[model samples]
Target: MPDLNPQTVAALLPATCRKVFVAYSGGLDSTVLLDLCVGLPAFAGKIVAVYVDHGLQAESAGWGEHCRRQAERLGVDFELLTVDARASNGESPEAAAREARYRALRQLLAVDDVILLAQHREDQMETLLLQLFRGAGVSGLAGMPIASAFGRGQLLRPLLEVAKVDIQRYAQTHGLHWVEDPSNQSSDFDRNYLRNEILPVLKQRWPALDKTVARSAKHCGDAAQMIEAWAEQTLPTVFDPTDGSFNIADLSAITATQLNCLLRYWLRRMGLKPPSQAVLQTLVEQLVCGRCDATAQVCIQGSIIRKYREKLYCIPEQCLQKEVQTNPWIQEQERIILSNGYVLSRSIASAGLSKNLWNNAEVTVEPRRGGEKLKLPGRAGHHFLKKLYQEAGVPPWERDIRPLIYLDGRLAAVAGLWVAEWAWLSEADGCYQLDWRASESM
Candidate 1:
């Protein structure tokens, strides 16, 4: 009976949203949804259909063309994006395709743009069951929300509560045509197997299975929101903004279940996926009970939760790789980009390295090599790089990746942190400052 309620859809969308982008695949759900959007007076002359081609199937290109033709028939704008959805290490092909599709869509959207996806009650029920089997917490059991923040924009699922049979009826009444993906029939994929072999059997046993499961999901969502509110109130008391790490000792005061909830809520707020139960337990054990000097790390699908110096940090696994590069300095070059995507720039300043000295030296930049030493401007003698990093409060993981600027075979500066005593200009000589900007990916 829901059948993509326009009143409910209107309430979910922002008043300022004039443009609507439908993630259309020329499939039944999307085709029906697109037709509904095209009929809405509020979205007149402002609807577009976007089809992403993952290039996994041989017929993907033909499907994209079909979607384009369908959009044209509906008198709406259309776009097709092609992406290589090849799975990386430790990533499944389905995950790769989904991520790639979202990434592509995100690039096409502006900050205020809204994208609509067509996933119905059956889809929601299946998601809940999948999360339950994986031993997920309240958040996962809640399934998908009606609306959520997408990359730099927003996403709306107007059909989330609508029944699949109602959508099929709408399509049939409208005399609509749509593509049927062959992959959906395969039992190799987990979702496909559940849809074909599991859900039907369950439905036979409980005729009202979809409605009851959806009701339970709604209850879980309400509880998850409460937990999120609690996390927002508690995070400030235990988080240290100065160094961007959590206070492990303070966190240890709470029960393990409370700790898990707090951690999952915090991670979700930060736009990062929380680790699985087993992985999160290991991480918490390392943080709450491990020795002060001991370092521990738990790698999840694409991220790593690390414990160091009695504080916890979450870093992407890709960032842990050593990205080192050496490049000869040019006098006129304003900025140098490192292998890790960090940017280093030279600027004239009142108090920095001597401009004349630097100009005369054969300058180069490289990542930190062991056994390096630097003399502070006010310190008595040169100190080991390891000791300097510790004194400066730099994490051990960041030390080796930071840039080292050398002037005529001697270390002149350590990024923007410090300039060597020998490189300090006299009162008469002009000075120059080095500015380093970390990668936006971090």
Candidate 2:
């Protein structure tokens, strides 16, 4: 490949994107990108350099300062963001740092703003190999796209196809100084191990390994897109938007390969992490063949797959932790924050509970203590909360935190879902309607 220059890099910029922010890590790869952007007429007065300090290494702060000074030397705007990159329960340090870096960059970008990174052909090949080793399907094997919609903006990799040797040559030709992260030399991480040990040997055997591997990744990406299109066609048959769950019977009818594709696509749509193959297979088994009475569940990362009443739910574990404590209701307070991360509010309606009831009775919101029954309007007899939830198709996990509003120590309404017949206003002048807003659902 010809040496990457400012003109070649500028030619790769998308015509629709005017604002550009390069994720300048003060490393060789990013240094080349930053220098190219500084000289590009298209990026003139439209470029900003952002350095994220992951705070993983002791010298991260100093590195950030170096990047800021470099940005100043180039006469470009600069911003620094500090974040904690400590690994969580099931996350690796490298993954943690990467997640934190992108999240910080996202906050600095606006809706149409483009953030550029400096991943080259070799990096792409390494990612493909890593995903293959992990038994990833097409999505992972496809590697990174040049451009994609990201948080509030788009992420672009202008040098994704550029060779690492070309980048190094460009940096040296420009007499630019860049930082060399010590972590890159540490083979303790999987990617570093591949870079330090595996790729060199492979490249010696096959001089064009980077370009060839990239071609294979592109093929995988094409196949992935085709599979995604197929999955989109199958979605309408298996999805139930009414309750935000999948229809087990419909999903079970599909082949295992189809099921796996749909499952990954659905999880991605919901902004949840895709489960590993083992966890996904377990989820499929529970969803398709588990006993009707069984409450089969599989937890992956921070999300949980729950099967209830023949429907599969991708519930965030944080939602389940919202165990609301009993609290008295204040009519004067327009909005009440529930312990379960929901909000209860009072709205006036032409027809609802009698306004007189609000003034005459003291109301409080509390969690159901069990055996609580409500005589809903138009229903023959009072019914237990459990029976009502079951009949209404409410998941068992949600039953515990569902608010039960009381009027003068008597059950008045099942917050926003139903109101007791006794609490119903007669031919009164006005009425007060209860409105509940939960994070996921009522």
Candidate 3:
């Protein structure tokens, strides 16, 4: 409504973008954006409209039809993407629907093709309030970003500065009709509760409530930037992408508060929400202070923090499959009848310390857990596998999931992580048997 010209939108675009993709939901905000894009003279590129059907609402199909008709009327290409909105545990219907909707849109967008969305000032204000209620930190309180990655594409919210009234007015001025979602009026959803109830009360006292909340978000955004800069400086020491895990000792050197902030901050940078403060505290404590006999594990909201070989690893437990196939990379196990009677194939790998090991060791592959010991060639009696791992400088994170190969009942070798002094077989024959393969399984 504030005279949105093609110049404004064009200014935000990259040099490579000649086409704009609008996520046309047939809602008031998107309708206004679509109308403005069609009317604005400065926009020279083609405008493509996309409507995603989450299949959660009964009227979603009808809404899709409406968007298609509107896009056709505006003389633009229209795409309707349908997706299933399966409910995930700890996720509400609204959240799941939204997640599915954007996933569909992201798939449709080309990396260089710009995506214009209608997330206005009110949405920002509501987001700020929601973050506050959820006890979010600076980064979480910073709210939605104006430009961010969506799948392989980038989503640009050009209307972020626009108000709800202005958006509605623009749509009305253009004689645009948008489908109204009834759920928006129901207070059952958190977003609706703010839009209809709390925000109105706040607006009564402070008329420019949305603007005020958005300003707070901007300040939080700046603070988050500062924290990010600090984290960038400190993160390199405790965490490394090359190692694919964190250095536990380096992490332990910091205070609990700093560790909590840095670890959560790091996770957020990876596009994962940080675990709760309680979970993070337990994770750091257990992982850092783990004994040789103890296995430390911390279950966060979306992932699990596990300790192995003195290193800390974050794994998405919810996404992990129950069983893994046998290969060099994964650990597999089964009890098999042998001359020794019921020998377990504790673990397997494609190769080992020496090629001759596979030929002479008669290795059987299987997974092993719970205080397993190994017999090194020079050392007599069984060496506690945990102690051997510690001596080998294996980080705690890697030790938990590290694969070990067992021959008969004695631990023959540790995969990729450590080798038993006794497990090594010296042979004059060329073409040595491989023990640990390049893959993850045995």
* Best of the candidates, TM-score: 2
What's the candidate order when arranged by decreasing lDDT? 2, 1, 3
Model 2 spans > 4 angstroms off: 1-3, 11-18, 251-253, 321-324, 425-429, 440-442
Q: How many Å off is the CA of 322 in candidate 3?
A: 10
TM value for model 3: 0.76
TM-score for all models, in order of appearance: 0.86, 0.91, 0.76
lDDT of 1 by residue, 37-130 (tens): 8877777787889999999999999999999999999899999899889999988787899999999988877877899999989999999999
Q: What is the C-alpha lDDT of each candidate?
A: 0.83, 0.83, 0.69
| lDDT of each residue in 208-276, candidate 2, tens digit only | 999999999999999988998998888878787665577776554788788888888787766776778
Q: Give me the displacement of residue 45 in model 1, in angstroms.
A: 1.6
User: Which one is best on lDDT?
Assistant: 2
Q: What CA RMSD would you report for each candidate?
A: 3.3, 2.7, 6.5
Better of 2 and 3 by lDDT: 2
Q: What is the Cα-based TM-score of model 1?
A: 0.86
- Positional deviation of 176 in candidate 1, in angstroms? 2.4
Better of 2 and 3 by TM-score: 2
